[model samples]
Target: MFNLAAKPFDYLIVGAGFAGAVLAERLAAGSGKRVLLVDRRPHIGGNAYDYYNDAGILVHRYGPHIFHTNAERIWKYLSRFTTWRPYEHRVLANINSKLLPIPINLTTINTLYKLNLSSEGMQVFLAQRAEEPETIRTAKDVVLAAVGRDLYEKFFEGYTRKQWGVDPSKLDKSVTARIPTRTNTDDRYFGDTYQAMPKCGYTRLFENMLDHPNIKVMVNTDYREIVKSFRHDRLIYTGPVDEFFDYRFGRLPYRSLSFRHVTLDRPQFQPTAVVNYPSTDVPYTRITEYKYLTGQTHDQTSISYETPCDEGDPYYPVPNPENAVLYKKYETLAAKTPGVWFAGRLATYRYYNMDQVVAQSLALYSQLSELDGSLAQDERTKQSIVA
Candidate 1:
């Protein structure tokens, strides 16, 4: 047991999200170190937070977070905190008054063109239409190389523009590469080996993970102020890297989102969990139904319409050459800054899923453990020399 009154906390973690929580838990349990975990938000779980609505239906406050990963170690690590509710995510894109499977699968092509295209026929059609660039540069090249101009214009262009607040041509190839074009009829959004939701909720899983005696949590507390008020040996920052360095080089661009949540008397809002609107007229990119994700049954259903914006809460880091250059400046600065380690999506300025964030946190913990062990050994050697 740790005596918080006697010993100061060894580490002070900035965000109470997956990165902060996972690192805090590991440091506290593994090294027997006291940790002070803080978040500016009133609650934990960061973007993955979910709660029950007035209708008694579980709804993700910040759009939807579907947990999907192929990493066995990541799966096993997270499984310790929460039981799994096996879920395979499916998404549909509303194009030309018709809903088609996203990722431009065989079904998506057949449905959109009103043609019976087999797997082989679909490949041939895509190849004939595809305009492969000599050197693929941007997000535009990725989609154009795979599905061609027509399908890219219809399904990706407007949606990408609306979602990122920029044209796909301006964004990095990795942005569109995240979504793959498939020849098979597999309608599932992600081809991850393990796909599931936490049985109780993401919040519950977080609560379980942070229940250690050595860890102290402070919600609605800013780390900046806490650093001024208290003393800590090390810092684990999961906030924006640019902000951490006070935008030394420049403010790295980030795409934010605004969600309009509505609870309807109807049992279901959409056909599936998420429906993407690829048309420019729609204004919003996608509408997500929570029950499909939570597997919750209720008389009334809750849904949220996601509208991308320039400012709200930073949801996605804008991936582009200019932003990459700016982030590199901050990355160099972070490396020079001692006793402070950065992790997670915002800190690293990368688009990472839930499991990826957890995996990253675990990896960071291992590195910290090694560093701590070396420091302890040096201290012991110094004390022996003094003796």
Candidate 2:
């Protein structure tokens, strides 16, 4: 167990990601409380950390995390951290060595089917080929409904199987439903109102978020070891909820990631920053080139290849009915745990992007602060005693 150097804090926040950062900022700035933010990683920004690579290009440490959200509050909140760059994410799929626009757009259809069909014609063609699901239950239902049997089988099935270690037919519909299909030729991946990356980089943004003097950061520290000793009146547990209970019920299933980052002595690799290899034959799911997102020009560039492995850092929760059932059990166990509020992707066991996690953390912080009157009363008592 890693030992602490100093005294405990007023608020002990686990995981200095979006959840802990938001809560720490709120309690430290708003409540005037001392908050200690801890993370197991060596850095602050959870999966959204970005910094200048060896080639001096701003590179996303993890896979590409494009900030896109329809939530006005989320957009406004992150706007404080860094300036926004106008970037709409476009992705390509490498199928049989031929690059095609993802989401099965009109252009993709025309290229794939070898027919110069217009938008309307493409729509009609897809309707003819699309398979109507019996009940529309799984990821298979979602893909078949959006595209068709042929497109679904070609693009999604193999990818889904390799990515999640499960057949699309057995997974939740929302898993594949995330990939949108368009009648028009809009090649943008997300159809959100706001989509952009930080002009300075995500690491700087996180640094700004947790720069408050009242907040203390302890990186490479697990919450399990020193949580009990923290002199905090309230605790925010943002790590795995099941682990907190010592897996009294059972270990919650988590889908992990093994990223293979390669630095090439080339200006560019692919046309876009992201290229999805939706084939089982390929060991990796997607390859993200850093320069495309940052618009940085250099002789060499760094790219991260996302390989969905069964081990390494847990990135996603396998969305299935059985997992949901287990999550509910964990939730119940979490709720019963005193002085601990579970938040963030890992704690909640939900797959959240950077923007979603920020928005969620912001909202959750407000709710927790407003949950009880003791916090307010304690502050008042401190002020009165000071007087």
Candidate 3:
């Protein structure tokens, strides 16, 4: 804990997640400035935190977070903290009592209908069944425009509904756009150039990132409680922008998730790390096996079942027209608020993947560095005038 009576920090970062941690590290290490980082949660790494369970297997507490990025800079920046384990994530959807490859690839289509369609044949088949909307507006439109109703119903519709607690037709197209339809037999979930996980786990990576002398971390401490006590030149807030403003423009809607973790006395449980239950009959959206993700050869394996809900910790920002309008108002307010900068998924009200969040944070750091340089130049100019 940092003493208030000590010299004031250069930055008071709220939320010890990626955004806050990245900024804290950059401001402290890069700029030689003091930074105090705090989080409401008791630990670091935010949702990406992983720990050894009773079964001695490493598992993500929030869910399975597989890091993949096309950005070389982002990948290189994170590599400083921890070594990498090359991992390509694959997902299987339980449809018609069979586990089929997700992303609606050629193999998925062929396996589903028992037709060995070539790549060209798969494209032709999709084209024949595709429905062109007048204007592609919603998640449903994105899918129907490519694969039509049958595949959409089987793969996305119910799973999306359960995941977001809303119908695909009501959500933004960006929601479904994340999942691509491959004409080829590529079964990998992400097509990024770099796909891997931290070899030691995400928590240790965060620990390395925050292990600088200039950084002071306080976990299980909310920023609101220390706002009056802590003294800092600027604020880097990574919490919900709506809540930070006290919901002056009304609360922004968010979809939360409940995770149920179970340990099984087996070496392996699932073929893949993740399996999606797209059927509406299933209560949970997906199940993630830890051994598959971590490559842990444990006698007992751990798995997590995700159940989406309206309450609990905010995970997904409800992406719809109405919510967008509301977030825009808050965004406008955020721009005018002095001494405070917002970044990350919650702060920006966008669904960002793990690597995307890191990229955003690194970008934010660059912006902050430029701003600081400009401020210092202005200060020097004023001193010259005074002289």
Candidate 4:
């Protein structure tokens, strides 16, 4: 809408997701700097983008983004933009013909095996079946060591293979380690202290965060297309690290996802928010019912079946030793590059949660604000929040 050459921006931030939006807000409002935020996609929220579907039911365009975090500061930082709807996410696994709680809880074990076991007995059952690995190395080991062969075959093996496009044994231990095994009947997906969603939705939350006059946002635009036009003091990149250098060390392997959204005539589709389909025979890994996440009462429910693929917008950086080594090469190049800073999951090549990304952007802002001699006042303001 305005002439790009007329004014120079204080920062050229690539990607209008959590990382970019947070920095743009901080630089503009905190240090009074002009920011140009750009995204290849036509929206600002990145993977967390949500909107009403054809059925008039709100749905996440990317997938189900359940916000949960243990860090109080991260929670407080995001809270400033949008009010939250208190929600604790719960997931179930659809194996055979029954629905069982995930994270391999006591209820899940008892239901799967048709054995009644108390919390203490549950531990004994698992302990007897668990095979302790002398060294835990890979994702398969993480599950095998915790639950042994039987549970691993049914619950984890196929699911991880389907999602990552590799056997769990070939992936990093951090992959399956993210999922926990419980002796208690507690079946909640995440055990974070704060679990909720933005009251107005993530897109609105981004709108509020980037509402500052100093931040100019342009969607459907790539940095390379306008790199020669707009002049800036610094660059903040949140895109894939490999692409930034034009894949010099070869493109780092990433896992992409495709969603098949189906709006049915029925009111409710599934019992819970998400139902994990761990069977490799099925193409989809999981099916999410949007009403459970949005809390919207609708006569027809919306369903999203997620299928992981190799071709699409990169959703996950493949976690393996080879890929990690390749990412390190790019990391080295990134450090050598001047006037550029890399942040967020894609740039760092770590599978970070949304709250973690927000925390990282906030930390970067603190670092930049200190360099600008504004940390002292900002620190005082930060401490005022009780949680």
* Steric collisions counted per model: 0, 0, 0, 0
> How far out, in Å, is residue 31 in model 3?
0.6
Reference-based lDDT, each prediction:
0.92, 0.83, 0.92, 0.92
Candidate 4 whole-model C-alpha lDDT, 0 to 1: 0.92
lDDT, candidate 2, residue 281?
Answer: 81
Q: TM-score for every candidate vs. truth?
A: 0.98, 0.93, 0.98, 0.95
RMSD of 1: 1.2
Q: What TM-score would you give candidate 3 relative to the actual structure? A: 0.98
Off by over 4 Å in 4: 1-6, 374-387
lDDT by residue (208-232, candidate 2, tens digit) is 8888878989898887776766677
Which model is ahead, 2 or 3, in terms of lDDT? 3
Which residue pairs collide, candidate 2?
none
Task: Give a tens-digit lDDT track for model 1, residues 1-387.
Answer: 545567778999999989999999999888898899999999999998999878888889999999999999999988989999999999999988898999779998888888998899998999999999998999999999998999999999999999998989999999999998889899999999999999999999999999999898899998888786667899999999999988888888888999999999999888999999989998899999999998988889999999999987788899999999889989998999999999999999999888889889999999999998999999999999999
**Tens digits of per-residue lDDT for model 4, 200-306:** 89999999999988889999998999977889989999999999999999999999999999999999988999999999889999999989998999899999999
Question: Relative to the unseen true structure, what is the C-alpha lDDT of residue 228 in candidate 2, on a scale of 0 to 100?
Answer: 69
Query: Of models 2 and 3, which has the larger TM-score?
Result: 3
Per-residue error at 227 for model 4, in Å? Answer: 1.4
